[model samples]
Target chain A: MRKINSRQAGKKVPDYLENNIVRFVYLLRSEGVRIGNSEVIDALQALQYVSLENREKVKTALKATLVKKAADAVIFERCFSFFFTPPETRERLRELRQQKIARHEHQIKEAEQVFTFRGEKMNLSALDKTVYAYMPETEKKRLRDFLEMNESRETLQQWYRPFLETLVKGRLRFWHKQLHKEIQEVIAQRDTGDEELNAIRDAAAGSGYGGRTILTEDMQHITRKELPQAAALIRRMARLLATRISRRYRYSKKRRLPDLRATLRASVQFGGVPFKLKYKSCRIKKPRLLLLCDVSGSMIRYSSFVLQFIYSLNAVVQRIESFVFAENLERVTPYFQQGQDFERTMTAVVRESGQWGGGTSLHSALKALMMRYGDELTGNTTVIIVSDTRTIHHREAALELEKLREKVKEIIWLNTLPRQEWSSYTTVAAFQRSAAMFPCNTLADLEQVLSRKFLSA
Target chain B: MFVSLEKLQKGFTSAGYICDEEVILTVYLALRLEKPLLIEGPPGVGKTEMGKALARIFHTELIRLQCYEGLDENKALYEWNYQKQLLQIQAGRVEGRYGRVDGDLFSREYLLERPLLKAIQADRKVVLLVDEVDKSDSEFEAFLFEVLSDFQVSIPELGTIRARHIPIVVLTSNSERELSDGLKRRCVFLYLDFPGIEREIEIIKARVPQAGERLTAEIARAVHHIRQNQEIRKKPSIAETLDWARTLVSLNMDRLQGSTIERTLNILLKSRGDQRVFREQIGADALEKKIRSSLV
Candidate 1:
């Protein structure tokens, strides 16, 4: 083992040889030192000793060898202790539990867990559903046993006593989680179900109880997936529109459009000479951007960015309608909220829609959107179809696209397919009957696609 | 860090930033409150520079923690030096320094210090800048709050080390990723935006004092154009603007006209992303639109 005197008085041997500074360093890490990779490697190299039994020694070697930078040495020292630190879990829990008890110790009113037995249908409130989810199987069985032991409500009440204490603890934890959830939600439903727990000795209450919530809403709150931040791609487009500068017209208002007041003001400046005055209006458009995206497997990555682009466009795309179509078309408007957890929400979307990872039946999916939303498309519609058109087409599908081309003013097809990947003539000639095709690989291209001036009026 | 921030800003007097005393003061108040000040802005608006400047000004010390994917407390704070301790025992026999040996060698004294520790144990109030924290994994964010709540670090060996005085903590993110609520609650949030052309021109003069007035105005106008063009991947960051200004100063150019712009495009834009976007917009066509818009 390498050795060196840590104190300044002695010659400092290399760490690989036996050294107090080195051993202490490694011990700090194993016993919980913040050891960096370089330190460990250096210490091991110095000692030239290889074995798992000397884990602490290795850490010490690293501390002596690696920690040369002062700030780093301090950080390493703090980290060693932190990693090795026990965190006073007991004391923190005691304080937390006391606080929880003081806040939530009790005033129970009415909370009933509604069950949907076979063939019975009843609307479950958010509270009822949450209670059901939070109830453990053991407690549920106890409740069931209690119910089975007696037919009358009074007898049931008698049986629920012993288990009441444990349930109270969990219940306090539950609502504390809810308080942490959405302050608005907690404020929304505050006094509807609670009063002092007189009938039962120890029931759930307010402030003190805190824990990880077991309910879906609580889970959603923690994961940030409870709300949607956008309505459609239009909002995103709007955001883009807000931060963009348009091709400004030379004139404030076009002479043809006739800005009477501006002209009069200019004439007044000219002392009523009333010479020719030009005017212009801002060229920014508020077009209804109808974004139709393909959410099939081949288009997953591109689809996400397309969604983000649509989301970012805030005011640019007016009344955006987004439909993710694989084999079926699903509108995911409610899942785009600011701070929404996409992982949780998207998982739910894929599960609920059940069509995301399936197939590409774009033509039929368009048909579904058309039938349901025929009124939304005007004569001046700009249909932005974002896809590479990957299909196991029942060739009859292309006819519907042709039909769609005939209806709207313009159809812009954004191909996610790379430039080199184009082997099919369908893009160059097939859909050319009425649609404009552009190769889009990145957000920049998508921006260009959406920015084309089709209709402003 | 605010005091440090002041020093750093003074150092870069020629970059043309009119340091809003109000914004700086607000940040100073937040730091005093031990709140994490979050600065958000489009890329290149000088979000990261603020942190670097604060580190320099503090004199107490600057501890920088660059955040990225899979970052954990171990990387940010510390880990054990296993090899060193083993060797210490082996060498203990030779010099008879064995009596002085203790496990506390692996303690705080021998422990390596990271940014977080430097800030906590500063002789003077330090500045702890958790840069691009949003880029790190979200799970680790919960742990961030635990430290923020106390301004302390718990070391099993040393028991605990808390801030003797809370250091100024600033977090800068590009909003490329959303931060967790746990973290958002612990800090004061601010979003930095692009300053207007007039403000930017003034900034150029202030930050780059030697820059010619005409050159500064032209560069600022060009920067304004780049910001307007969303097609570019790398928007001209304040840093790039400084570089362009410096280049112009060195070249002895008084004004920015067409050819001068082409020569310096590489300085303003680092990659193909910026180059392509710049090419698409910064020419006669773009200028025509700019002029036309102005005329009416």
Candidate 2:
């Protein structure tokens, strides 16, 4: 084994080794591993005890000190291997590192030019510097005077009233959009060769431009061929939703109530009078879920996604009954009840129903569904209708939905159509009168509904 | 504390624990950085045993806090000595110094230290093992942020108690429940799966020295073969492999026959379902096949 005392009393290690450690930590931080300032110092000290000759030990020394999660450890291992190449490959890495530093210095200069606010002359706080980037020239002057004026500064220092007045009336959203657009323009002007900046741009593409959640934008339109990736995402969402719902139910169960009979029984041991309290605990039953999906020709893509999403949740939810409808209603719950493979079961259900590529007529389907399963709906059941109400040449069926809503605990409508398209559809406004409606035109919308409505409800 | 990774590997071998390069490096970094190493893996992978071995290797006190459902800060951290506080109050009243007893009940004299508090208050370094931390509630996991990052405990009355010597914290999890991201951010993650055939043989030799070389090798090979069947619910870990070797040596069996396998099968397989699956998958002929290939 090669032995070297890099920490020999007041002597430092070679400059190359020190730079290697710092660069490794920098690469880790950029890859989203949370490495604090103290963690860096601890890693440097840890290197003194590890053998640099053996690559495994040296890499482990960095990982065990730097990474905090098992997921992050995978990223750390990949980066450490790339950074700590053989001596022959070191020159290429050094050249890349130098190029990266030069690019970073250029980005820093651009940021300094962009963020150099005139509010510094008025002795404004650092918050004014950030707000100045989004403000027009006229507003910048107004804000400057507001900061310099004694009375306005006193009001701003109050923190509560000033904050409410400043952010109220949707001003925060306007400023946020302005700042996002300004920053995007600045970033787009830079060299696209930067991999790190490209990663950020790719991430921003999914969240929409200017960080705006446009209701008219159908962000994720599922297709038949893309079912595998959607299925995986649904399975992960199922696990999280299941844990959250069960944890909440378990928490309520643990808070026991004082039972009179139990307290009286325990009092007999203490001379007919109770000094200590005894409680009775009961388990809260999980709410049953009933899904009615519209599988018409207009809603084929959305129906498949909603069905897959609900079936994947069968692992967490004990009681789930699913039905698909176009002109007629057919219960597909038995397929899921068989515990078969997900894709096979879904394919079997789709073929057996034979409702694929059908015309829209929710009126007849709802009437048939109620006539067949009237006794199944109860106050313990949550009825969810995943559909787009294009009614076509059928009745509105608003009164039937109202009657069905009274039988169930709650009726949640996950409208696959965009919010802007709802007003154009004749039957959607009437249907919304009976059920609590939420937009489900995108994957982000579906995730939000699952977390907020299903888990919390 | 180790000269090299190989030296650490040898040190663990002498300590009767055969570890690979990853484990040795993780433990050495844990010692050098003084950060908590959170070990996660499947059940029966010797995750908890690593904590015990590290404590032994460093010759530090091992403070184990076994976590379960509804584990709270008061249970894992510190609690007040109610009876001692009452006694002190009575003494203060009898001595006519009732006014002086204010805030005295919350002092160190009336504090009963739990595993966390004891670890921080320890004069020397310690190996604090929070075993099966995933079994605990999310709130308790959140409460560990202070003790983990700053090595201190905060009480409203007693103020903060900092560590005199930073303990070597090792948290073990079987991944029964997902831990919070906040707690995961303050720890170094290490995952240990079941040992391979060669590592299993080394572990068997070190843990069960009384067993013959041929018998140990045969047991390791058979176990390696058995673990290949994914249908088996609980694969035999290193501890189970050692137990199997020791059982064979004590019974004076040189070969692994059907009767010997039948007699000591329970030592390796815990569940009846897993045993049934193993027996159905690997029958008499399969056992003979494993034994034949084990020699060469």
Candidate 3:
């Protein structure tokens, strides 16, 4: 007759939303809206920092970063205070939810008009800036021709850069980032005063500018702030692959690919048992990977990025020896056998990792690891290091790295910095003396190192 | 097929099954169509015994494949007779025909067939019970799909043997992890539930012939009343209802009284917590009135 209030009238609810903070964060995982600890903590921290006066804004703002996608954000908000239910209550809740959905459908129509107006302004902005981002301007001919087919304020603005647009909310940030290099190039062109414009004219052979910027946006060398390029960047890495293919093809005495002569010769012994001759050795060689990450405060941003990179690369690598280092180093190799949860795995990583935000001195850590695992790294091994070379004890640790580098076949260091930031206390720079190349400090550097330095090598 | 749902309606009325027609037909068609029927629902519903009863009505051989973790083909399918093969080799060498005779015993003919192959090759119609499949691994689930989809076996030495007729395949799952789409698409899905009080009264009277009509009805009413609660660990299945009815008959009781439920607690609930929870729900007075009302 009455609905059982298991959550208890929520006297603690606004307080739960307000005080008893349990923020439910859902990661826009591969399957669906998967709640992860990063989203949960972001929602929790957003509650603490943001005032309750703007509840809807705080929810939207928190969910924008915490939830991975717009669709997931809607689910995370609903589950944030979702109480347990008995079987009897499900039908009633189903009916009420359907009714609410019908009402929201109407609200969406009205919200859509406002949404569309904002969309038209964004289209005008994109068409004003990049000619390609705009609809083809048979526009003055038809009303629909002026706007994109999927034009809604949310869809149109973010459609320009789907990877980044979906990450933020009602406001478009990283907007300045899109036009950053372009503005700088335009300013440089103005100083050169029509010389660069002549290059565009020359490139176009005196026709109207086809309107691509003279500075080609080479996606092959895009930096790490764009996480979406991680896939494309990894594919361009040829040397890493050449090394893998070479090592994989290299045969052991015990293992060999099917020799046609060997199989045919053996077939005659069985008096032409052609059925037995069908079995043959195959070519399959996957490499074992060993990864060392620095999770000290300086490398926190790059640590997550690199771990995710290594994890995504698991389809190629046979084994990844994953380790996280701060003041001390610890192995989390087995934990990543199943793919990473990114934030949750990193949090478990940071919690048990023993030395997070502690001090760092690679000499003691690497020497300890060298004594522990010197034999593990042989001629076949490839060592990938993800860290900022700002070691706590710079000079001594640089010497330790030199000693460790002798044992491994190759060391690839991914440093998170612009080229301009690399001039200062460079432990990674010093560590590079024994490595294949000086540290790649930016995502651009990572891509360049992958393409030119490693792959092409 | 399973009475075609339209035909199942008349069959249910005649059989006094008093439940949803579609659900019964799905169970029926899964048998008739020769596809594994995966029946999922809350316990105390007759999910397990339905296969047993269907085997009875159809006069077919029922081969049960009980599943558990780490159950490999060696245990589930057929393992070679290592000792017998060794003895055959010794005996064949004495006769100087080692190669020719030992090979025949190792062929598909001499192989020990477990439930999976037994169900396929039965002389009569077979009802294969792949019970508790969720406890098995994903690899096993995939392996099962290959065999179940095609009722055939291929020995490396001998070629494949297809089933002479499509046998009845019934697969039951408790819904631990979502089954692969490959497996679900190969079968009919049916969700069975515990019967309501009125239907359960009729089931007790039908299955438990020894119990008096008044006593069976009282036991059925008490069982339904207990099933309504959510907190009980294991619901009293239809088999349990029959067990409870037979217990009263052995006690020489003409009617189910307050003391009878307490004495025969095991017949109603298999688990300890379910018995305790049921006792707490229907206190002293209701158990007394159970017999008093059924007398009418």
Candidate closest to the true structure, highest DockQ: 2
- The sequence of per-residue lDDT tens digits that candidate 3 reaches over residues B1-296 is 23344554555545445455445644554554456777666555766666776566555778898877657676676655544555565677788885687447657645778888778778877778888776676678888888888888776756787777667777776653345656765665665678777777777766676787777777777777677655554667777788778778888987766776777887777876566666766753576685476556
Task: Compare candidates 2 and 3 on DockQ and give the better one.
Answer: 2
For candidate 3, lDDT tens digit of each residue in A369-389?
A: 788877667765677777667
TM-score of 3: 0.42
TM-score of each: 0.42, 0.60, 0.42
The fraction of reference interface contacts (C-alpha pairs within 8 A across chains A and B) present in each candidate is: 0.00, 0.40, 0.00
**Per-residue CA lDDT of candidate 2, range A325-422, in tens?**
88878888888887665557878887788776698777877788789988778886778888887665434588778888888888888888756457
Candidates sorted by DockQ, best first:
2, 3, 1
What's the lDDT for all of these models?
0.55, 0.69, 0.55
The segments of candidate 1 whose C-alpha lies over 4 angstroms from its true place after superposition are: A1-457, B1-17, B56-58, B93-102, B284-296
**Candidate number with greatest TM-score:** 2
DockQ, per model, reads 0.02, 0.18, 0.02
**Residue A218, candidate 2: how far off, in angstroms?**
22
Which CAPRI category fits model 1? incorrect
Weakest lDDT window of 10 consecutive positions for candidate 3 chain A: A189-198
